[model samples]
Target: MLETINRFLQKWMLLIAPSAVILGVTIFSWLSSYSYLVKWVFAFISFVSCLGLNIRSIRKAVMRPFPIIVCLVLLQLIMPSLAYGIANVFFANDPYIIMGFVLAYIIPTGVVSLMWVSTYNGNRALTLTIVLINTLLSPLLVPYLLHFFIGTQVSMDTYGLMIGLFWMIVAPSILGVLVTRFLKEKINKTASFLSPFSKFALIFVILVNGAVVAPYFRSFDGTVILIAVLVFIIACIGFIMGFFTARIFKWEKGVVLSIMYNTGMRNNGAGAALAVAFFPPSAAFPIVTAILFQQFLASIFGRLANYYFHVMRRRIDRRQNGLTGI
Candidate 1:
């Protein structure tokens, strides 16, 4: 049952995760609560998750970042603006609901999604680079995008968000990478243990976000679902647009898949964090929906990359040369 349950959650967004987050947020808001537990838990998970990277990988990525950099630029700037334009067409008059749409629109790439890219053999370095660059630049690009598009009502603290993102996301990743590198001989024996903790923490963060956001659903005026639809549409557009862009560049399958994953997956965790700090409670609904869209399509992309890109194509090429293959 445990294994089966785990599979289901893996397949269904760590099952009940978004639900739990919605529930937690609702309770927190109702009781006037801001749990350090929730924040630290997410921050810790985000930290430990990135603990396996090294400066070597970072530098290598930096040297050869054209494809990834272009994708990151599109994801951080153009796509968010596109989401906003579509959203404005629907959410023009209502400021609070537009808040939800606008908040979800401007946030950049996610780190966790890069894990999915790696697990399924979809250009790990490229995906990791996108996450790193977008995050590091979020201090500037995120605020600029938000200001240019939405203009106000957002608590624009570029420094705070950057510092918070670094502490919560980038710094932890650097530390994690260092630990894995310097202590490889010692930690290698027990590194497998980190997976369970990381998975649990990720689900916990999702649940907390859900719980915190649930309060707004009670009085939601239908705009929440509309914004959710908007997020879905934008995510799908990202997937398709990325594929075409990769085709234009004549990238290999790995590069193409990398772009697809980067474009499609927004950082819902970061989005939620921003929502809580910068906007009203109801402003987080689109971000909440984004968690679902990101997790689901990312999983599907991972599976496809694993089976088709890694396994099947290898088999096809091997047969052409009369050799056995993966």
Candidate 2:
């Protein structure tokens, strides 16, 4: 029964996300009271998602440090900068919302990205390494990046943000890794059991966070629509940038797939959590809006990656056959 429910949730996740947002909006008053629980839910999500990570994969991935470095730069520095610029150009009058845009991109790459990477036959080691390293560093990087980019515009509790990220992301991640190390094969069943619970928890988090941003939807006018459009465009750019950057570095298709997913998918759950916990409600709006589009975009990009690599393989095969006079 648990497995059946898990399979159903995983199969229909793309539809579920947006539906949760709508449901939250409809019942905003009831759900908004539970907003404080967002942090706990996110911590649980972080813990369960990290259960599948192999510590040994980190060592293997680090041996090829250049690709990892490239991904980190794209994930942390380049994307946030792009988001900041785009947000400012369009919404200069709305600093909180602009802060929302920056926050959405600067958070670490999503652990859920591992699912996408695995689905596309990506480099699991590389994806795991990137997720672990980026997540561990988020407590530090997120605070500093927020201060550096939008500090003057909005007052933030930097210390609180750090501690929150530590407990919610870093601490839970470490515990999950330890379980994987010690429990070994035993933990696989445990992780599998918890996987569906984690998804349900994520849905709950989205619903509650969506309630926090319900006011925005009530006044869903031109500005709101524009923000949604901009968010979608920026997300598309992340995937495109990751793909070309890998191609430019002459990385293999597997690495390209890993980097593309990592670069493209933000830990929006974490983003929404921080937005609600520390920043104004306006900030959470963009993050919640991102939840609606993220999984759908990932599905589309996965197909695009498949088609892109298939064509490349066909061309290579043709060249080889021509050379052999076949």
Candidate 3:
């Protein structure tokens, strides 16, 4: 019974997520009171999110390197370049804003993608592999890319960011994976019970993070709207690029789903966390606004993917029937 409810909630996360963000921003005063708890919320989210990952699945995906390599290129090279260009064009006057824009895209693939992949029946091994590999590499890659792209113009504590990623992401993930490895049966049995709570934690994270930047929303203007639009467009490009990349490689449908979500939806939560921790409060604007639209796109795209797969299955079945009749 509990598992059924959790599955229902996960299926409708699209609606639930955006609603949470909106509610958070509306009651900013109440939410802001708990502002001090944002980091701990993020830490808890990371820990619970990792509990689902299986080391064996990650290893299976890693052994098949082609999709992994393509995802890395899209993640590291293509997405960053696109984001950097967009930031420079629109936010040339403020280096912090540009930093926010860059950080939004440069962070690792999100742990949340695992939820989407599982719901859509995508290759769990491949999704887990990409998420784990990206998470592990983030401690080094995120800072390096920031420094490489923006130079001295955008000041960030590279070492500090690395340390944060290590403790927040790397350590928690390893802990979860190890626990799952040793106690697979027990963990699986308990997962359904705990799933809803983990999701509530995710909403709590969003609400608190929204409250942190809620004051900015009150005095919204043309520039804020423009920045939001730019972020949305750039984010969509990530999804579109992922779609093309999957088609070019002629990947299996499951692999294609993994690619689209991995490419389009980054762990923007990491971007929000980084902005709040290392940069000015205003630097978090792009990352915060991004949370609103990305989830919506994921929801839309997910429905479309379902329709597409259904149509393709029908076509294949018809062809088989025709062959048998002849």
Candidate 4:
């Protein structure tokens, strides 16, 4: 019965997710009073989500380093550059928006991205490897990326950022791996039972965090709409670039899916938190606004990729049949 219900939830997860966020915002905006608690929830979500990974997958990714290198290049270098370029063009006068834009891309990919990768039958090993590696490196990388792109215009709490990354990502991941090593069966069972709840945690995060920005949403101006449009375009481009690059490299289907997601989605939650903590409120605008559309875009990209994959398969089948007859 549990398995059946799991399947159902998984099937409609994309639809259910956005709805939950909307519902959460509508019903629990007041819960924003305790938004500080969301960090622990974020940590818990990270732990359980990664609990399923084992040494074998991590080793596999290490053994074959090409995909990891390619993914990292796409994710870290290409996407950040793209975001910076776009921000410079769109908001040349506003350094805060530019900082926000670059920050969104420079942060590590989200932990919840594993859910999407799993939903689309992606390479779990590579996804976990990329997420863990990115998270592990984010402390140094994020600050460097920020300095490189924005120069000394923005002030960063380097120590605070490091602490946040370690606690939110590295610590939870280590605890999760330990649980996997020593209490494998128990952890696995618990993760399975609690897996769906991860989505709720995400929704709650979005809700509470969304409320913080709700005031900004109520009084929108031309600049706000422009930022939203620009973000949407940049995000779509990330997916496209990842998809085409994976095809060029002739990666497996699962790897392709993994690249699509890892390239497209930023750890917006962390980005928002960092922005609010270190930078001005204006710097967090892009990051906060992104939470609304990131998941929605993920769904669209997944379906689009599936459609194209099927089309290519049908073409190959037809060509094979024609050659057989000849």
| Cα-based TM-score, every candidate | 0.81, 0.98, 0.92, 0.90
* Top-scoring candidate (TM-score): 2
Give each model's whole-structure lDDT: 0.67, 0.92, 0.81, 0.79
Q: Give me the overall lDDT of model 1.
A: 0.67
Best by lDDT: 2
- Model 3, which residues run further than 4 Å from truth? 1-5, 312-326
State the lDDT of candidate 1 residue by residue for 1-326, as single tens digits: 44455445555563455555555656544422553354466666666656555556667767877897679767877787787778778878766556666667566666666666666666777777777677666667766767777677555666776676666666666666678777876664344556556567766666666666676665666666666677788877887787678868978887787888788777677677767665666667778777767766677655654555567577877798785433
Candidate closer to the true structure by lDDT (higher is better), 1 or 4? 4
Could you list the CA RMSD of all candidates, in the order they appear? 4.5, 1.0, 2.2, 2.5
Please give me the total number of clashing residue pairs in predicted model 1.
17
Ranking by lDDT: 2, 3, 4, 1
Which residue pairs in candidate 4 collide?
Answer: none
Q: In candidate 2, residue 14 scores what lDDT?
A: 81
Residue 185 lDDT (model 3): 85
Name the better of 2 and 3 by lDDT: 2
lDDT (0-100) at residue 203 of candidate 4? 62
- So what's the TM-score on candidate 4? 0.90
